[model samples]
Target: MVKEIVLSPDEIIEYIRTEVKVNDVLEIAYNRVFAPGIVLGITPEDEETGEGLRVGLALTGEILSDYVEVDFHRLKDDILEIRHNPTGDKDDEEHLIIIEAEMFDNMDQK
Candidate 1:
């Protein structure tokens, strides 16, 4: 079975710290697009930005292949759902995070 949870920005950071690990594959959905990438690393909260967790991902696509860092703090309100172990495996499962479409809509304003 898959477990779905809605968490605040801080809670999400805590969850990632305890549950997620490097090299784990993650699927992030935003702006009606799914970007699946391997987890590179997780950065702790930065006092300057007051941001919680910053996840680095190596995204590869047909046309574009690059490294991108996702600031969970910025997408706090945009986070829609977090699905754990979507494959229903007792161990060795992946995560899928769905964000609201508007997340990228106003990206330039951020």
Candidate 2:
């Protein structure tokens, strides 16, 4: 289905720049050189479980995509349709992810 773009490029770039700068400064200030230095976001617990998840992932890994076509993105209102193709690597898991977003935040703004 056709979709509308909720976020403009300028907004995404600006937000990402601000985030990267803040994260960098904090990392340096605290002498934290670890991976996921600042792009780590904690996922809230499932409704059935009250505890948060322990998985850690970088912002890029979670948002950026090296593959396209097979993976399609369409933004409509507050919903984003993302169809990602499964690769031969990692057991090949095909999935269609529908995201509820205020804007198009799928592309890596880095």
Candidate 3:
């Protein structure tokens, strides 16, 4: 079996522009804004749909203790759907590394 890969936040951003063969299990290192924990199941960019990267917040580790969880399959459906901040109307897309706070809270719910 191929070994899982762990990528930093910067690398995750890079994957958005460049296509990378994602492993079965992918880990995204902690980003201060998202808290300190690894995010798993990073969906690679979908060329056909022209979508960006979307990463799942893992259920295990510090995330679990904090009551955060991610639906891996749904997150992979459409990367473009991911947004920054709780409100969908936010204009924070200009930020290089952006994650939707509401998306995390919504996805993390059991």
The C-alpha stretches of model 3 lying farther than 4 A from their native spots are 1-12, 15-32, 59-110
lDDT for each residue of candidate 3 in 1-110, tens digit (9 for 90 to 100) = 12223343344365433532222222222322232223434555588974545554433344343323443333432232222222222233343234322223466655
Q: Give me candidate 1's TM-score against the actual structure.
A: 0.59
Models ranked on lDDT: 1, 3, 2
What overall lDDT goes with each candidate model?
A: 0.59, 0.26, 0.35
- TM agreement with the true structure for every prediction: 0.59, 0.19, 0.28
Span of 10 residues, lowest total lDDT, candidate 1: 95-104
lDDT of 2 by residue, 1-110 (tens): 32223334333223233332221211111012222223233333356853332222333334452211110011122222221112212222333111223443469544
Judging by lDDT, tell me the better candidate of 1 and 2.
1
Give residue 38's lDDT in candidate 2 (0 to 100).
Answer: 30
By TM-score, the best candidate is 1
Give every collision pair in model 1.
Answer: none
